[model samples]
Target: MPHQSTAPPTRFHRSIFARTVLWAIIIAAAITACLWLLTDATIRNTNQIALERAVDLDLAGMVDIHASGGREELARRIADRIALQPRDGQLAHYLLADTAGRRLAGDLRQWPGLHAGVSESGPIALPGGSAFARATQLGPDLRLLVAHEDHDIDALRRQVALVYVTGGLLATLAVALIGMTAAHRLRTRIERINAAFRHPDEEALARLEKGSLDRDEIDELTRHSSEALARLGRLAGAQRETTDQLAHEMRTPLMHLDNRLVKALAAAPEAETAARIADARLEIRHIVRMLESLLDIAASQARRGDRHGLAPVDLSALALRLGELYADSAEESGHTLKLAIAPDVMVEGEEMQLTRLITNLLDNAFKFVPVGGTVELRLAPGPSLTVCDDGPGVPLADREKIFDKFARGSEPGTQDGAGLGLALCRAIAERHQLEITLLPSTRGACFKVAPQARR
Candidate 1:
């Protein structure tokens, strides 16, 4: 029946580290794309310029031949150039034509669609593959065409694309690795701060105190949190001191008052006077009990704050011993007491506080259950303990409030209690880092107590 602490669920995309890495990769890809486009344009422009130059040189050679030996000489020169060039998987091609567009002597069969100056043409089907051609005219009638294959330019584009893609992938991976490392360091710092809050011990505080001038925002947070805890510790110490001093000062006066009331009860002669004195004595005893409970509460709080006087104790043995001690009392009260204790359940805590914690729970169960009803004490694995009574279960509305000081749920005047028993039980449990919760029952009240560590 122990309650658990709840935390919000975290999504992968929502994490700050994940978001940072994702954005970094996106920016890198965008930059790579821009660079690829720029490089592709540059390569294409350089190839085009080179192709134009080569075509112009060839045209100039043909013009020289024509000026030296007329049109026939130019045709003979073009034929020789074509015969000298290799045809197997050749990227470059050439063609020459006469004034009537009749084939003279060259690689090409006929004139391609072109202008006088260097112009781009397409896929002029050839032996090896398709081509992108640059054509120029040697004269108004004579035409010359030079072409480079499409596959050459395509291969260059593929090579550039491969380089960019590979580089982009490597860059993204590097960014991710760096981001993961940074995130791990950040998470460790955050966990340290959280541990400081949870433990708030001297060691934890000392770790927080070691600060640096080059610290980040997380360090600033750690400093602020440490300061807050120190302030709270001081205030808690002051409060404990005040409570202890007040309890000490009040005890003497209360004892003296109780003694005076006892003397008055003894001296009173008349029955009515003696009865009134008895009532005052009863009230004094109630006040004394309240004072003792308050002191116990303060002591438990102090122990929890400092974590002092802790030792390993056999909880199962302690529970068994308490059950044996209380069995007779239960029978005397006309209630059936039952015990179901396990063996060798060890826990780390102060024996005295743990004893009081269990005793308070049994006392409450015994006090509220109807005469002739059953009260059961159970100790099981996980070192869990439960006390149940076959009496009116606590009302739903009063379940939480019952653990507060001076808060009672039963009909007024029906129970003889000052309403501090459950509150004291809770204080002791908290001191031992235990959890106590009210369990659902079919017939009566059930309370379960167990170590928080087990949960």
Candidate 2:
């Protein structure tokens, strides 16, 4: 299995869209509330001042009437003013009384219950509403009260407040909807860039839209990243070409030399000469094997995700066959080769590469395991192939490094050829989009081949 990140996502990785939306709502609500408060204060203050001025006009008119014709004329003028009062929403109250508190003449029925003098400058509660009232002592025996009814002002404020809240709520909802839509588009574009970064291949980079001066930082990053990927792709292509050429060009000469040595060994007469010729041939064969393994590794690595010649491979049958082939060799070496492959297991791959992957793992286990050690091959439902041996298990430090080319295990066996077996195995597994892991075991090495985890 591929390595997985078990670490928790930090604050930055959490749903930033949600946080942004929440903050937006808070700010919108706050702004809306502040606007409402300012408007309400202005409306209340301006209306109060206007109503007070009208009260002053009414008070002056009554006071002048009293100054010219005494209290009786003042009461008569008050009645006339009330009779001619316009039917507008603004209402004015008038009250006149003797020093003994008897109603002389006015619209009000009785003196408003209030502190004697100062209460006139403040709001006084009326029967069905409230009013600003002012009282003036006309003479030793008479009093005058002028007041303005302002209940409509209170009602207007309430209606306006309700409207403001409604508008604020609607505006907030609209902003939320717009924010969500914009965030979704942003996340989509960001995820595409993130996916491109994850692959970092020229093909993936080309799919990204090019950035211009009009765009933001993300697009600029994409533009630079595409250029970087192109450079990397070119470098990788050159490296792959070099490796392919070296592996392919060296093969003919190596085979020719091996063939010449074989003939030389056959024609040699003395035992010593024959032995030396055979050793030379063996060395040639080892070199030839190393070159072929290197070629396989390079080819598989180059074609990692190319499923051009892939077909449905019956892994169960293949594992069974390889198990049978190696069973005799295991027995000859005084070891048991146990096969636990499930039936009808299958995978999509090139059979030849899969065969090499399995054989390399088996060869590796055999090389390390002592005589009489047991080797177990398990092929379960995951198309998982695990090769276990009762030999020296891989050292803790060398587990990850052993997959690299020319890297050998801690336990050096006598036949540790060019250490390309595990590397080739990893390449083939990667070509099939699989992962090969060195599982921890109590006794010997246990290598498991399975599907790579989706990050």
Model 2 per-residue lDDT tens digits across residues 118-230: 43566777775788887877877878998888757778999999999999999999888888787777766666666665555555666764432328886787677677767
lDDT for position 15 in model 2: 65
Candidate 2 segments whose C-alpha is farther than 4 A from its true place: 1-33, 69-120, 126-129, 135-145, 154-226, 292-359, 376-387, 396-405, 411-415, 423-440, 448-455
Best by TM-score: 1
lDDT of 2 at 206: 66
> What TM value does model 1 have?
0.71
Give the C-alpha miss distance for residue 215 in model 2, angstroms: 7.4
lDDT of candidate 2?
A: 0.80
Q: Alpha-carbon error at 92 in model 1, in Å?
A: 0.5
Alpha carbon lDDT of each predicted model: 0.77, 0.80
TM-score for each prediction? 0.71, 0.69
Candidate 1 lDDT over 332-373, as tens digits, reads: 889998999988787777889889888999988877788999
